[model samples]
Target: MAFFPVFWRILAALITSLLIFHRFSSAQSWDPGYTFMHQATTAPTVAFYDYIIVGGGTAGCPLAATLSQNSSVLLLERGGSPYGNANITDLAAFGAALSDLSPTSPSQRFVSEDGVVSARARVLGGGSCLNAGFYSRAGHDYVRLAGWDARLVNESYQWVEKVVAFQPPLKQWQSAVRDGLVEAGIRPYNGFTYDHLYGTKVGGTIFDRNGHRHTAADLLRYAKPSGLTVLLHAPVHQILFTSRGGTRPKAHGVIFTDANGLSHRAYLKRGSNNEVIVSSGALGSPQLLMMSGIGPIEQLQAHNITVVLDQPMVGLGMSDNPMNAVFVPSPQPVEVSLIQVVGITHNGTYIEAASGENFAGGARTQDYGMFSPRIGQLSTLPPKQRTQEAIDKAVEDMKALPQSAFVGGFILEKIMGPVSTGHLELTSRNPNDNPSVTFNYFKDPRDLQRCVDGIKIIENVIESKAFSSFRFDSLSIVTLLNMTASSPINLLPKHANASRSLEQFCKDTVMTIWHFHGGCQIARVVDRDYKVIGIDSLRVIDGSTFRNSPGTNPQATVMMLGRYMGVKLMRERHATNGPK
Candidate 1:
């Protein structure tokens, strides 16, 4: 692959083996003191900890590790570990993890009530194990809006950066995307930086120079391992609470199930400060809250779950950043890459790209899985599962693609700070099943307009001189109803039937970048300290707390929040002890 920058012949050969096999031996180096990590089946029927955190994902992993520094903590994850999973640890197989729809896969697929497809991380490292490794800090304005201690936020971000973030070496395809963004007037090329600035810039990635991913799970290395217990395949069923003489229900423990369907009860150590933290993603966190009887009275009543707290806002105000993209099938082979270069516009849009991924329908030559396509509409949907009807419809629409559409690159645009929002509701009481979530993409007129603007910019980026070499203007994918068109390398369709107004295009093709946030938001579900309102000894420290998506990607900030809040909780604990 001449597309990649020059490297040693031996190293190149090793990388090829790693990518092909989807495994890396080097990932086991951190397991020296990881004796505390185990499968949920191995856990005792009853246990006690100073803190019990649900969902050992992007935030939960780091939060548990940090809290364990001074407190005995238990981190529960519904999915298995990410270690040795080539689809997760290898950079070349970027989308393979999400594409995997197996019962044991780290990524769990879900379709919203709006018919949009997305995934949630069920693995120990969370989305960081499944996402395209792009790492950029939350913007300064976002920190100010969240009312975080700026200095501490910076410190937390740096701590995470040191463990997982890395400067990526831009390959041929990524370099072109960067040039095209500037050519299209996205302004000052900020070289390389982690700050979420407006303009084209090279941000950090979690994939290190060795082409190996280091997830938030690695943050456990900094933890006092003896004090922290991590159990995998432990899906928390419900949070247990106790009420004292008319006061709010105080969360004291939780009931979770192991892989064998056996129940286990874990309680907080006997202390008023001991707490239960929910760091599940936007979908899981709120779903868990509602299952625990802390949502709207009507919802709880309908589900037959006894209401512990009639908090109407628990599952309200959900927002997903709607994305639209054009696929460009290069006549010549392009270098394989994930998101490394980004174009951040002041007009609430983010432009990004990934190249050389093989979509099952597009490139019949290979089967990386049905979800390998970088095209948002197809890749994010549940494959032959709960939304089989929707997937069948989506695949039927994909039949319009020319063979050229399958083997190329994708240029995607995402709307930031989307004012449009929706809500999540439970379909079943089963904690393992995905809840009914409706992102209501582009519900706000302004959000739809931003999508239009973003599409126009993407069209410009494709037409720019920097991107001309990869453009195949004649190729196009026929329209899918309310679905983003798949291919138009030059952003122009030679077939008249494939053409539509930009606004209509935006409406029809809207998809998700999986940047959904805002179910359990501040001032609604949780307080400034992320403590759940109307409840005691419970907190939510995940993406669900945000009013908006923090930056180009929320993973970086999400991980930072885990560390930041963990430190804050520790400080508060120390203050209460007063120089023990």
Candidate 2:
């Protein structure tokens, strides 16, 4: 009967409820001593810490937790904890989490100078708390190029995985994408593995079976509770320097502000080879560096910041891997899925697929108590108005979902790849404002060409025999530039002007995956050990340290780097009786 499909969906939800109730009953409380908020404004004006790390985000959380094992550590974050936020914890509200423009939302939305829409995570867990939850390791060649010990990186991946990663159950739509990738020439489907391969493979995810998400903040469970002090709503203002006629300006401490407008100074404890580490994501790291007068000489002078160390590449050559998507519509209901399968193109491009919820309780927030009063206060909008607004927004956001209850029963086949680099720079000295980002997407001729090739590869997969059953009368590729779907056949023609049309599409519709990287790097801003070249007792560890985007989802890379830096710093600390 026509109602049978509805009955099955309800049955699934009932089964899922039992699982959720069980999980809630058995869940244990996280370590309490490791966390603090701005309300606990009791921090002394001047406090000493063996390692004072600014930005308790993706890299910061894990790194601070690891480093706190032996030494006293202070971790400061600009955003609140993601632990209790239902919008963040429910995997079903994944899109809503990013679409949320409220300050309280984990993601901070922004537009690049060149008009590319993007966002950054401002929560304690960082990007892992906001991203699409796709997890994959960096390309092996990238690991070797960075001169990182492979064994160590492997161990670091395991450590993060045990806490947050899960094997996604491949359902209908995801399985189709997997076969399409293989049939379209992305051969050798690796069943289930985290190793980066040049074919269709099922990678790990952060969302669990019942759709609960565990963030990098969950890794704090491994922290030395007594040694780690995590202060929320504490944003670092500037890095304090003590020259004392030293050759290199030594970073002695940091000046930051707690939420209640209280100023606090966290200094490296004397007698310990103590230091300050900036793990404040890509944009925040360089901005903080420049604010402390460690960027380009010209920019520093323009901002009236006393030049401590002029590093020209401090905020230059930022690259946000450009992204394009192809939405394939279907009448059949497909189960909701995050990134379960990915196709690694031969030419630095990565293709993945996702399906929207066609099942019951698709409205995650309404069903799961995500209507937070805090979000309305942050957005400065009326409460019900905000709820209604998000619901209206979901109509558009849920298009990639399967067709049963929620609309847009379609399989979203997306492609994101790296090309020429861009830049991220400070617009001003105010840390409260966002930085000036220029993704420079498709600015280079080669980049445009790669995008066209990527489109062609996706088209081939859509037309392949594997996907012949789910025929698409018209394919619409959505970008930041377009409002509605535009057919691929019309966009990519075999006519004389086909090249021109495709080139124009790549230019007009090119958008970013918000996967920005390399505003600061090893040879550019930091040295081999991730220390700023011209500064002493300071280091930068985050996505900014990446020389280039790894051509896959960078969350895994971000967490991996955090884990690597954490383990590496601890080794050096113990070996040298403290940091060098």
Candidate 3:
């Protein structure tokens, strides 16, 4: 065999072996480190805890850990542990986890009325366990706007970072994407920092170098085992409350069902400070609250459910941060990624990318082709001329190329701050039913304009002279969206600037980052301190309480808020207790 052929085979075998190693290695469970993870089947029907926390999810996990340091905390999760679920703990299992529709799989799948497909975690660690594992500290504006103490927020980040976040390694495609981002006018690159800055920068991730995922549940390692008891697969049916002489209703306890469908009652330890906190997500949190009679009184009565608090905003103002993406195919396999490279723009948009993600279908590296040809020099003429040349080249290349090997890369854009908001309300009083969520996206004409701007940005990034050098203009998102056109890449010049066509495309194809928030907002549903406004002994600590969608991935922000809430609750508990 020729020397180059030998080298190619060796490289292929090595890559294959490494991929196999990663798959098996990530298939294993992460040690929960705490010995107290229990199932509802074995737990007691009646339990008492100084603090009863509901929903052991992203926020719930850390909150329980922080609170158990000072109080006997009972953490209840409606799903199983992240451990032993390879899909939840493995980076190679990324797409599989999101697409999982198994009854017991951590991901709970759903589709909206708009025909968009998405899923939420039904597992212990919640979204962190199911999401792409991109970790960026919440934008500073979010903390300030939410009235959170910046000092405490920073401190809380450290509390969670020490357990879950990791600095990711930069490789081929991601590095190329970074260069493309810088070329697209995203600005001065900040190298490998987790801070949310406006520029092209490599940030933190939850996947370690070995492709193992360290989720929020891992933070349970910090839990005081004796003080914290986490019951898995234990879904809370409703918040149990009691009234006091014409005053606001107080959350005293909860009635939840176990994995075996057996119901149990868990109560607060009976101090003025003891409380039940709901850390379920936007949908789950609002759904749970409404089920407990804390929603619009009229809506509850219409459903024939008792109204406890009559708070209209309980399931209002839902924002899921609608997004659109541009995918480019590589000529060879690229390392997988979540969101290592981030481009924060001054415009109301955030551009991020993954090295190995493409939702568009086209000629991939792995596809079969018949012939391979060598073409002459291509031009840098004006877009129309250049696009025609590129389209011709793409057609010629596809027609002649032999069996290929390539990966896909994505340039994703999320609307930074959408004014268009939607809502999530219960489909029924049944706790088992998923709520009806409508993310009334692109309703605002301005939002549509911003999305149009976003598409132009992606087109610019793909068409940049810098990108042209690498043939990055070859198979771009524009070409993919131009699936019906005569020529894919050639159609770019026509559709990229056609704001109306692109806006219509966005309206037709827009999907969410699934960063659902509100439906239980801070000002309208919960107080500044995260306490339910008219209800005592309860708090909403998850994404449900966010005032508005943060610019970036809200996971880090959500976890930070969880820690901050724990610190606040602890201080209040101490104050309620007076002197030591």
Candidate 4:
């Protein structure tokens, strides 16, 4: 009996082994969906490589992709591969898992001296991998007003669209607010055109086809080349510059720390005039520069670190889109919200929308906005003018509403507006230390006014005829009704008051959408070419380099800047060396 049992066990074990092998072999051939190929063998330690791009993110990925086709290139990322986590491949899973996996603890979040937390992303694909996939181009007018050559900007935008494969959502949900805006006499504009200037109007949103989010990682996957090497979980500590010709300082290599907290130095290949491109996103690029002794002289001196470059602008000009959300009860108690994305340019329109069915692949129909000088010039206006314009528009639209009509639509009023300037500062000498970020949100008087303005606009929209069908009641009314019915008022707080204005509701409930940018701004840290003023072979090509945050989501603009910088670097290298 014992011998027979042993024989059966052996047969079972063999069958299990064969089954496992078969499954494993099948998985190898099945598409993994997203690909992350890391080179196993380290490159030769000699200073080599035609280009060294840092961050492997929204910007760095494309930059390395474009440059590596014809040259030896090195791409370094501070986090592990995007595919390192299976959850990352699923859009909903990524969103659900992000909160837990985020590096900063809830207690250690970057708080300004005034006590406000600024959310930042630290991962292989950086913000692009984690962002809410809203792809918008830089308004042509905005780019032109930033003093970029029109021809160059146009070319760059085209290249970016081509490489990134921007797509719009297949189905769109029309918000009750859209009808309200039109009824309130606000002109309706197609929000996401390549040639249009995006306005304050609320009618543009796009999503991918599979109902999965389309991030920059998707675009970059296609651009990956064989020679390009991506190093994950490697955080660059500092750039080591080798002085050439006694006066000219050139970059030779970078020293970085791996995930295990061990340090390693990567040198440029021999005889290769390598350039280090930093696309570490808005928060990271500035942090890296400050750590490498390239920021404000006083701050560096305070840290007992030698200032390699006394660029005070390294952390200045910090800006981000102050976002707020309004949650309205669905009129029909729907399971999902359809998002329609639009950009209102002066001369063009861009529109994208997505329904639950196609959320994975993103929006199906995409329209590109054209270059327009008027829209971009808005940033150049005096701060007072900008504030007044935003406020007046809101007020004018609101004043036209009748009180009785406003209470009829989906009534949860969430307003996001009134952006505030912020700064990114190093809290410690350690590269791993989170920076002290101060948004000073709503600190500026103008920002407060803008928030108020946004609330008023919402109120006006609620009063319009388009919303009358939904039957949106005030919070007090809903609460009273619930109380009378002996039902739990779950959505309302116990401290709620009947006298609160919609504006007050907005103030108490709004939160940041996490679109930080504009610190380490262009023309401040670097010139038109994105090269740091005093450093050679070093440049910043990420959201941090924006002179001003465009009104739309910044992913497309960030990618465009990366492509632009990459092409320029390649062009310069070719011109100087007469083509590889």
Candidate 5:
């Protein structure tokens, strides 16, 4: 065979192998003897099971897999299957779709409503299959403070690491910004490793295998259990519950509509005592709950949604990490594309992990070293109170370090930006209606100030002699000030501007990086066990339950929560009765 043909054949085989691996890895139980019978002659009636899990995405998949080990599990997903779809499993193809596909396209969007768009994946594996795999555990102190039992959370983290099979990228590429850090004197600092914090002047590492991205689908699909039944293309409209006389309400089943728009009800077997766990992510879980009368009374009433439980906190405490892209001219072209420089707490990660304790008790524990001390300090402040002074100090600290010897070949520049706080709200009562997601990016005055501080620090670093050999653009503070003034009230303090002249030069250059989270916050709607407050047999195990947004990619934390919650559910069930 010709060399080109040989290479093509090898590539094709590798892709096929990866797809097969992903499928088998996510399959927890697959019983050849078990079969789903559809009554063709009659209207689809409620079918019973021991557990009903909504949203077969990242968290839901793991939860279903874990629960199905000993119980009859029904995994309901609103979107269609992702397996065997070239558009989904193919990374290059998926990236293209991200740019051109319609916002309503299930394979492309997070949430789209009222002209506002957020990143959401409606396919079988949810965001896990789509996200850039960067796995890091939630801060230890934050987890401890979140009122999560320390032992349980740690065990869950360990189990998650095993299940996800997280592996850091072998090749680390440095960007112009990272070079600017070296010139500015920033050195690579290897902080606590177990906490998954590796502070280098460059970007945070990725989780890839042999140059290909690994996803949650790769993990759960292979371990699919025979006892577990996954129903794809079935969107859950509402959770069905039953009242057991004066006691708390118990979720008994779910009402879902299939892709063909036919409604069906799945009931729990009598005396089997099933529970309904909602892991539809931050956007979907809260939205579904509110539609079923489980949210704020006023909001539900305004939408004419019948109030079921009057849970005021169903959709409250919406939060997310605001991200802005900074472009810098590189002295040389680079190979690595995505890099995360800083992962700050700013109340979101800490509050969610700590469970709403005071900052001292929440993030001030031993695991604090896992994060940038400067970023950690900023996280200590209320989002509104973070000032330029604090941001400047953190930047100064970063500038004082030396560049990594491993990444010395590239000419680096810096891209300093802001992290925004946002929330999600329902636009209509319809299940198909996408919710209104107001990221409120850069709305807070302090958030803007931090970006300015970050930019200034980057400029100082670039001016250092370490980077004198390389040629790059100098982003000035004046440009930040001017851009802040010229931008819209909601999108001001644009991070892309490198100079005051640049800000003036391109007044319409602001854009969003799209990292939204924290709508159905934890502790308020759901307890530490992930069980919905005041509702029995109902739990939420996804990013939506984050008490606050974690400052970095939320995939790892979401998976950890799923593992933790799944184990907790199993343990509790086992305590009451002998193991299955």
Candidate 6:
């Protein structure tokens, strides 16, 4: 009897392991049928759909997928597909896409009017393809502020998680960072979770155990192939409107250009419920609207774009979270890793870190975007290349070094709910050109104070006992702030008083965490349901609708919003026209 029990136990364990392996393998190979996907050059000159979504990005992909279940959808992406793009799918080659500034690359470079370098996603998966892969849901207060239905929000988050989110395995550097955050008094340690909690915790990631990233585009696997059509490299020029002697303008179609520079038009099917949704990112949404003659009268006319509606608030209220970091060099090589651990403080400061030799791989030497501009004389590069250099330079320099001169990792701090705001305006009439936007980082005194407070916490972390081994020397806060070898960019003064130096540091070293949001904000550009206030059958449902960026990373909530809004639109249709 004892022998039989042992044999059964062994058999059960083997079966469970095999089942788990099978599940992951299936997920790895699963494919959404590609029959309906096409290059814009191959698309017909005219197409009609129940809904037309411009920008196949973080929110657009999922929204299109969800809507495809019950209606015909056209998803237009200005960039190429993410499928098989190793720079995007491989976690080790993380910043590769951002560094590739070619016209066809998946990341588009932009320089904010505040003089900060930044890039936006030009791929089907959007920022999900370019971010650090951290995945955490929005805070409870954020959900309430957005006026989202709690139950539906939870359901939508789960739907996205099942296909994309995963528990990140924390290696040595990340584990040490987590301990340091705790030792510095961030809070109780909450192990692996997706919830946005105020403490040092390991958050979910889109990267799998094998280090492959599953992006929002993966959600398309749930889409109905027959009902969805995704066009790659299709840049929408403007939304087309027809005036039937109505009080408000009605959007019925959009004119876009194909990869071959040929024009094409996509229209919504004739139905009271049909709509044109703009799921382009924060910058793109407002720019698209203005390009279509729906913005401030002076700005539109300045660009030679005809004015459709003088919506004065179209390009107002833009903001980006400012980030600062300290580099702790190690005597020994550390394992490569992206963001896995984070410390969320009560005052809305976020602490995170990443380490690995691959992160400092030699291939990125010329990538000004990922490294310090001082490293390769990148500051002297032409304006075009300089614009591509958006992320903080230390990290970028690390990736460029074949053999890193500084074998270490960075512990960074980013302030939340930034009070300072700016706006975006078209620089040219061409839809493909980058816009002139200013986040006006640290313009608000309160936001500057938050940065100072966050830096103090980081200083504590660097001095903590848990982080001692990673420090090659006794580097002071001021010295650490000036650690990077070269740069025309300003650094903290070595002898200034702590108070003055810290505040100045906040202004001088303020780099974007790439979490910019708000332009076409809710109540300003769109209604609660995301419908454009003065435009019938037109909506904007991306991060542009957020007054503040949600969660530590916005991808999860952005993706969830896609599904949530898709379901809401579906239910409304069902109630009005009956279920299909």
Off by over 4 Å in 3: 1-27, 357-406, 469-478, 484-500, 578-580
Give the winner by lDDT: 1 or 4: 1
Ranking of all predicted structures according to TM-score, beginning with the best and ending with the worst: 6, 1, 3, 2, 4, 5
Local distance difference test scores for all models: 0.78, 0.68, 0.71, 0.50, 0.50, 0.78
Compute each candidate's TM-score over C-alphas: 0.87, 0.84, 0.84, 0.72, 0.70, 0.88
Residue 368 lDDT in candidate 5: 14
Query: What C-alpha lDDT, on a 0 to 100 scale, does residue 23 get in candidate 4?
Result: 10
Candidate 6 local lDDT, 1-580, one digit each (tens): 1222232222111111110111123234334557778899998889899999999999999999999988999999998888877777766556667767689989887778777677899998899998878999999999998899999999999999999999987778888889989999999999888999999999999988877889989988889999999999999999998767656898999999997899999999999999999999999999999999899999998988888889999989999998876555565566666788999999878998876442233233223224333221123232334343443443343343234333567777888878999999888877789989999888898888888888888888878888878765544656556532122232222233333478876676667788999989999999999999899999999999888888888999999999999999988888888977
Error of 1 at 411 (Å): 0.8
What ranges in model 4 sit over 4 Å off? 1-36, 39-47, 84-86, 102-118, 149-152, 162-175, 191-207, 222-224, 244-248, 269-273, 342-419, 468-471, 474-510
TM-score pick, better of 3 and 4 = 3
lDDT at 405, model 1: 45
Show the colliding residue pairs in model 1: 22-86, 362-406, 482-508, 483-508, 483-509, 484-509
Badly placed stretches (over 4 Å) of model 2 are 1-40, 357-417, 473-500, 578-580
lDDT of 5: 0.50
Candidate 3 lDDT over residue span 1-580, tens digit each:
1212332222221211111112444356677566888888888879898888888888998899888988999998988887877766777655455544457877776655444555778888888886767888877877778787999999999989988889998876678778888988889988887788888888888888778888888888888898899998888888998997998899989998887789899988868888899998988999999989999888788788888987888888887677776545444556655677887888787777665422124433211010001111111112234344453564344423222322345566888767788888788876657888877788788788877788778777767665554333344454445431211111123343333388866665466677878888878998888889988888888988875766478888788878888888878777888633
Q: Give the Cα RMSD of candidate 2.
A: 7.0
Q: What TM-score would candidate 1 get against the native?
A: 0.87
**In each prediction, how many residue pairs overlap at the backbone (N, C-alpha, C within less than 3 A)?**
6, 3, 4, 69, 51, 13
Worst 10 residues of 2 by lDDT: 14-23
Candidate 2 per-residue lDDT, tens place, 363-442, comes to 33222211122222111122234465564553333333233323222222233435567777778876767989776777
Query: Per-residue error at 389 for model 3, in Å?
Result: 42
TM-score of candidate 2 on Cα atoms, chains taken together: 0.84
